[model samples]
Target chain A: MKIWCDRANNQRVAWHCRSHPETAESNAYAEVFQLQRSFIGTSPVHVPTVADIQVVTRRPADERPAVILLELPNRHLGCQTYPYDDLVQISRLCRAANIRLHLDGARLWEIQPFYNRPFADLARLFDSVYVSLYKGLRGTVGCVLASSDAAFMAEAALWQRRLGGWMVTSYPVLIDCERAFNLNIGTFERKWRKMCAVAAAIVQATKDFTTSDGRPIVYFTPEVPTCCQVHTHIRGVTRERLAAARDEVERDLGLSVFPWTLPSPFMHELDPDWVLVNGDPLAVQGMDQYFEWSITDKNVDIPDAVFAQGWRAIVTVLFA
Target chain B: MKIWCDRANNQRVAWHCRSHPETAESNAYAEVFQLQRSFIGTSPVHVPTVADIQVVTRRPADERPAVILLELPNRHLGCQTYPYDDLVQISRLCRAANIRLHLDGARLWEIQPFYNRPFADLARLFDSVYVSLYKGLRGTVGCVLASSDAAFMAEAALWQRRLGGWMVTSYPVLIDCERAFNLNIGTFERKWRKMCAVAAAIVQATKDFTTSDGRPIVYFTPEVPTCCQVHTHIRGVTRERLAAARDEVERDLGLSVFPWTLPSPFMHELDPDWVLVNGDPLAVQGMDQYFEWSITDKNVDIPDAVFAQGWRAIVTVLFA
Candidate 1:
């Protein structure tokens, strides 16, 4: 495990180190499993961090691998989804190595537009697949694991019980997920395209503005985002100004823009440039502020008027 | 592990075998861990099933047990809460043996009234304790683990993430649980006492009248229950009849009686005589002819008129 992790690039670090303040970067070496057995670190790839399992499987016959776990749309990297070629290569590598592959497709729903494939067809690449109902699926709380191996799934079920995931009453979550899926999944691709269009328009409209220091007032972390989600930064604005304008945007336009801070930051990336200004988002409100947002079925149809009002409010707060 | 399970008795099958039809009874020998490293089987004893540390500690000087796991208020035998003596003895044994003891206190709330002690004091007996929020606490879904060992807890926290138990947004559950704890925990003891009184009265009122085979119509499984919850058998009545009567009782008396089946029977006990009669009660229509109810704060003060009407409904449904 140590040997495999060491083979990765120097920049490779546990995905958690990005958000956990206590996690030292030195200790974030991309070890698959630590001595403690509990601290398995994540590989630093884009949202869909596809592993070419062959890289690890090339080891001596005596050191054959056990399992290869892949995240379809890695949540940490702006929900970046893997392409079919990456998945096919990994699948072939696992097949050759005779190691089981597990897909952590938490945000697989968002990947559909990029892949243009059925969920089941994509799932067939791995020995087992876990699709979350919450991330982008809008479930109250739930996930599902699918595989052709009945015995393996049964074992998974047992482990779920041992881990306290075997809920007494999960219907509330199940019902909510089902409803959300029915309402949202059908038009996700169209929504994604629409979102990309809106994002492009916003970028074009704001490209001319500059901060006092001359940096672009509105900047996209990735000049062109691959999916519906984009990490954004407003250079001249404090978190407080963005937050105040956030309420006004919703009031005037009935559309919500991303707040600089969220109660749960683990779900998003870590950006050090941002500073939390005011208000308690969680139990005690105070933490670094960052900006992120996604276009989904729910928000794909925001009217031009609303977007204009929201952008205007944000600009007014920062420049007025 | 096989030797220990074999000694427990033939009726001492794994708790799961009672419900899982695929699990053969003969194969139920309690193996502590399988070759794959998964732990299986529950102890056959009631609450506080203590193993004299001397038994294992006496083996070779090199052989030492790492941990002792105990389930307080054993679920199968009617949530039997452990006494203080049993807890003290187990704690002493664990300390002397140098083995960590963890308590599966899923129904710890139910133990408070019986032990007449504080929750923290009971928690101190074990190295770590897992208390459920959804069981008697009535939360949507959550649990709390208490331990003085920071490293061990940190390790456990890591395992929680690996097992997908580290949710993106658990505040929904946390907030609901907080609301429930505030509303319920304060007056739980008073409510419990009241419930016991009501249960006793119901038992007395419906004790007589035999079936065609001479079995009593309203029979308590244990004759007298050890806790607030009692498994009741309403003999010779169809599931539909009981379901109808259940609704009538709620409407006429504002008191609830348990339906024969629940959506998640794994959290509850196994009662083989009754079958899952119909729809998912958690989402839709209810089922099962068997009846069970608990004396809790919510229903402790059920009016005498309501109780009388409920009894009448049951008798009328069964005999009419």
Candidate 2:
């Protein structure tokens, strides 16, 4: 990602991307490149609008942003993706402005069922696309970057050598990536179906519960997930209480409800607003916890009723 | 190596090291850091003398070299190491000059039998030391850099993160490294003993052969084994003739004499002198081929006589 951004920016300093709570972007911009805090112009949405690109790019020729980065089905926003038309418009805008478009497709495999588009078709919309072999493919570790530009890839190869990414022996990782990709790529649609059924069951079970301040106790960002992952939020529960409930439920019912939870990320972290946005009621009230719930073949065999039962057990212990 | 050099050099640009045929130094200085051609002051010897250090370091306060890099048992110079007393004197000189010193100890483990000193004692002579876990230790792959300065290591850690050296998983490589180290570390002295025997036999077998120009056809660079590796030079053989002879001998005797050979590196590549050094007769004549012959457990089991026989056959084929 750093290599791509550095090459794409090409002496122009600024870049634009949607505002989100991913640590990777901050790590690359502020830590690696040491770019100024103001160098990243952001829009507060899963997908940036055409107008947002214009606003970010409206600068003197020397100051204009060199690239725009977009995450497919932004995970922080409950795996919600741009409508295909919106993406086409954004791609066209960047092309017209001579700005490069990059895609962070770490979760691309999970979202494939929702888009029903070939990977190549989706990748064609961006100047460069990065995909992880370990994320949905269940490989040991590694990633691939695709681009039509030969010069860009050649530069990436040089950076790879400079960074010591060329290992003496990588056959183990490569073999595992191939095996997992072959075994798992075709199973995402099935996993998505199972995830939707589980989400629906849990929603029905927790619908009647509410916080002391009268907000619903349990809800999901986007309400209906567009992919196999969703952000599940539980209001009126402190992080400590949720942890304790999680442990008790696991011990008593032999079910691990969620791996972990954290207080909802503040809206200000994703945007410049000093005041919390009313749209994110949990962050405004300050007593909500959330975790990313994702599905894969490992969890697809568990009955949907079991998911509802596990959440019910945790909620009972939390409200007790 | 890049991270250490960058940190040790601080603001001052100039640095000094003995001139040698290793490509690693050039890659780091010219390719990675983009240092100027004049930044590296060279001494044309395996071990830079105290006078050489004075010459390289005598500069304005702002222009003095920030660090000196030394390769143990300079591989290009037949693995000939500096005498311990000379090394002690050089260490004192660098200390008085307030210049950091680094050791490229890629072959440190192989030389341990000759030095008969603890690894820690040898490493203590420099501010930073780099040892290859793969080379003499026979690990799958990886290297370790040692430094007493905590801040320097912390900076390396940050560089590691920025360069993506921190892999998602590394247990397999770590386990293989440990296994190889344990299996091979204690066997160096035994391997050294075997290599010395092999070298002696080859020396006796090729003593009678002569080049068309009457130079000795075969000679060991150091004329005796210092460690498990030696630079074996064939004075009359061109690279192509040696390669063809190698194939014929391997096919007929089922003995692989040397993996590959290269035309002897020009003396001018290591030193600025346009005229070849009188001491290196093979380079002066321009018809020599050489290969680094390293001994390990795998080759130790083969009879020493087999190595002599293989070389005799290859030489006979070359002369015919």
Candidate 3:
């Protein structure tokens, strides 16, 4: 297949993806090792994404492939709704457009804890399931890519071998797979419950505080908002005043917290219309006390009533 | 894409590639799930090959898929001169008769130590290579199928997800994949070297001790054969005789063993060609002594060099 594309000079976003332009310049057919994504601009974190795949698949008129591959998120994202791999959504699109959809479910093992379901229950949903020996199962290392339709699986073996994946002695991986199959269900259930419980508790403890419009302060969201995130605001309430209030709350609640990394104070005029606190972790106990003061003690309350300007906590937790 | 033929359900020996009535009933669309392959059969184990693929492809069967998939040996069988997946052979066969051949290397990692070559080097020989995190590498259960061609990869990913191999939060798999990639290579390498050395030592130890036709009271093989392999003959030897011999050998050598598992006096045929001495195993130190015995003892002087051979003994230095 003959193709042409531009080169990446520095750390810049490519036409379809972000990569070193020099890579594309050198090899017409090398993996464009994705370094960083364009989400939350200029943040240094690795997250290979569906959006990235979407961009590349729509690269050119001629280059559009017969199929587009993507990992299917569990039906729910931690019981909270967010940007999820909508199989139902995309499958219809693919069928209408005549483009095939593929799923990469390596962490299917870890996926189940979110649903209170079994791995097998979730796996049956996919066209083909490539299950690993070790990952969620903690097996030795190996995977079995299976499908309900025998024909497709029979043909896929060709690709498996072509990719240098065919191996001998699946015995070791069998060990891991078996362990995951037999042991993981319970472990995952317990851990998932714990993770959900902790997360829910944190949300509940902090939800009693909200923005002016009455949106819950500590809200649990299935979907991270698009381009809407939390940031620092230091206009109305001086850092010192906020710090003093923080100290008072901690003294009342008996909690310790770092000064930096705490949410910044806001002046009424400069306060955001919808002041949203993000998933970014903050002083948990202090947050708990801040809300405690907002709700319990009315007489000795401070002058900063914007926070107390008739607020109610909204706790949205993925798990109970 | 209508096609021709299916894999035969004929017993292992009778199932060499061919059109069969049995196949018509068992495999509808040339789809095959070869479960019985793990058995290598007896000594002269051979690779099953197809003949007409070359002649038919000469004219290019337009309706047929351009690709044919095949499975490879389990690594425990180890690599020999052919390195079955070696593209030179497949490509040569393809070029000679005009066809394309792909591999199903799902467990290719185990096959590596036997090849004793770098992974990338072996990968370069194939049109594509698939690696699993769960296989020997013990990554999250998934396969990373790579190809010399980017277009092929693009095509495969669609199948991958369609097959339900795609997963969100495969980050867990990546973490384990990194661990597998880093940890297994060395462990596999060391194990392979140790096994091969053990096999080689067995061969040399029995080289001078074997009868003209290469039968020994106790011998080894170049093939890093499986545990419990055997072939041998001794005068008047029965099951008990073999057991006695094993017990005597271990006692004299200060090693541990199960005499009952060995070939014995009454069990030996008058003319014996080969008998597995249960793939004799000893500690690292004992193995070194085994090598020394191979070098120092040119021909063990059979004390009762007659028809009714008696108890065997040797060396005056009390080496035990």
In terms of DockQ, the best-performing candidate is: 2
Interface RMSD per candidate (angstroms): 8.8, 4.0, 13.2
Q: What is the interface RMSD of candidate 1, in Å?
A: 8.8
lDDT of 3 at A283: 31
- Clash totals for all candidate models: 3, 0, 79
Q: Write the per-residue lDDT of candidate 2 for residues B162-274, one digit (tens) a residue.
A: 65666347766777889989988878888888888998899888777886567668788777878898889887667887899999999999999988886664454554532
True contacts kept of 1: 0.06
Query: 1 or 2: which has the higher lDDT?
Result: 2
Q: Evaluate residue B82 in candidate 1 and report its C-alpha lDDT on the 0 to 100 scale.
A: 54
- Give a tens-digit lDDT track for model 3, residues B141-175: 56676777676666565444432244453455567
Roughly what TM-score does model 3 have, to 2 decimal places? 0.35
Considering DockQ, which of the candidate structures 1 and 3 is the better prediction for this target? Answer: 1
Task: Give per-model TM-scores.
Answer: 0.59, 0.88, 0.35
Which ranges in model 3 have alpha carbons more than 4 Å from their true place? Answer: A1-320, B1-44, B48-66, B69-78, B81-86, B95-100, B104-121, B132-143, B154-180, B183-197, B207-320
TM-score (C-alpha) between model 2 and the true structure: 0.88
> Candidate 3 at B234: error in angstroms?
13
How displaced is residue B319 in candidate 3, in Å?
A: 22
Which candidate, 1 or 3, would have the higher lDDT against the true structure? 1
RMSD of 2: 3.7
Question: Which is superior by lDDT, 2 or 3?
Answer: 2
